[model samples]
Target: MKTQRGDIPRRLDTPDPAIRFYLFHGADEASSRSHATRLLKAFGAAKDAMEGGAIKSDPAKLADEANALSMFGGAKAIWIEPAADEIVAGVEALLEAPGAEHPTIAIAGALRKTSKLLKATEASPHALAHISYAPEGREYENIIEQLCREHGLAPAPGVVSRIAGMTANNRELARQEVEKYALYLGSGESDPVPLEDDVVDRLGAGTGDVAFFGLGDRAMVGDIAAVQEGVDAMSANGSEAITILRAMQRRIVMLAPMQARVAAGEPASAVISSMGRALFWKDKPVVTEMLMRWSAPRLARLGERITDLERRMMFTQLPAKSAIGEELLAVARIAQSARRR
Candidate 1:
């Protein structure tokens, strides 16, 4: 019968003994794959993966695989990707096989509402079907939080939003990020420490998708040598100076609120924790140092400066590499001199 997305996880984790066939299809293939993965993990049995095309070509093969026993004596679960109406006859054959013991999980793309496979799966008492749709707003946040819990992730505020935004709300990607947190924290299906924003900032950001990470971070923290090194490297690669400024601009925007909190008498750690979780263990000393050094007024001024630079750099025909590097160097030097005094 048709199933709800929220209930599908329960069904996969502890499958109903009466049901042997599982069908998942929808516009969100990522969600479908995630469900299929959950079922496989729950089963922990050997897989007997068969393509939907192969089943469509030989309808009897589906039944043959399902009814057959493994020589090694471990249960064999069938896997079908791109399950479609063309496999209807094969699925029907599997349904008809009285001796079918192995569970079959099928992943399909968006299926037409009138698709015969959809109807057959829904109508069969021995079979189950679920449709996945892209989650919107709070729904996406809720899903991310659930995944985090399963993986022993105790997310701080904004952690879920960052993951959801970074993964573009894809369940599989979100699951991966949460799993990473669990791994890093050594949390194995157990209570985990609050997941912090600094940890995600250092770990997440779309898997190397953000090329601007280092440039801005180095410039803002008054790492004069590092800033110059980063700029020189970018210039060597012919990377636009605007890209560097934009990355720094983002960092400044994120830091502005924390700076305000710090200015209001809260410790940097407290401010950071309020935003999310703390930095990972190994990076604590260095991050704490940076936190102490980041002045509210200076960070605010840098934000303004970087914003204007980014806007002006957009249409400039001049080579901006030297100009941008010099600007960052000035910010770093000022920070350095202020600290020295």
Candidate 2:
């Protein structure tokens, strides 16, 4: 059955001998990696299994390896690392088959809410859990609270909101920011450490600046010349195309929720404050205007286009600069579209 990320801790404790296949799918690699590690530990090394690549291309080998007799027995756990579409199809077949020996765990880099794999996993008789790194609704705030609690501290008033705003649904990054603050405060402090604006600034600098801020500043202001120049500079600096697309995708994804929050009569300060202290005062106007200009549907479409471009880059032997230029054109179009709308 389908389960939420929060429910994962409880499910891991269950004593069921039935093979459990967990599909940890999310945009955040850190969260996915962490979940995979937890699964490996719980099932024990004996019965634990891990695989990678396209499933269909080598189904026989995958099946053989996954179904291999457990070294120590007890409960078996099979983990399939991030794979191509073909491999995902093979996994779907395995999930459909009757009487599999061991519980299979298939991890996806990202899965859509309505994906067939997600649906099958949810419908399967076997145990299925989905851990999404996408922070939706109250999840962002919840994560901040959880992080504070874990560090044995309470976030000062508005601190949680501030951190959430800066991170913008990037759970792994948010966690890192909180951990940084926690460390800065040192262990076993007498009282809860209140985050100051400077703390956020330091964290942002350490994390290579707000990537979106750099991209959006050029893109939103209709500075095509500057955008091209900046892109060239970034390429010259040896930044990967995938990294650029991923950052753009993240910012676009964040804008919708942010826009919605703003429309709901939330104060600009409150809405912006929800973002961690990492955001600079200079970024506010550009980001805010871009949010207004780009509708949610448009941003979602742009994100999908970027995903396709990234996939092509990964699977094919295309020249990185050309492929990246194509992706940048798409970003430019989004900016133009935002202006027209």
* Cα RMSD of predicted structure 2: 7.3
- What lDDT does candidate 1 reach at residue 208? 37
Q: Model 1: which residue pairs collide?
A: 196-277, 197-277
Candidate 1 stretches greater than 4 Å from native: 188-191, 208-341
- TM-scores for every candidate against the unseen true structure: 0.60, 0.56
lDDT string, candidate 2, 38-68, tens digits = 6667666443545555456676555565566
lDDT of 1 at 336: 62
**Model 1 C-alpha lDDT per residue in residues 78-180, reported as the tens digit of each score:** 9988788989999998887785778999998778789999999999988999988766456878988888878778898667766665665467877888888
What value of lDDT does candidate 1 attain over all alpha carbons? 0.74
Error of 1 at 242 (Å): 26
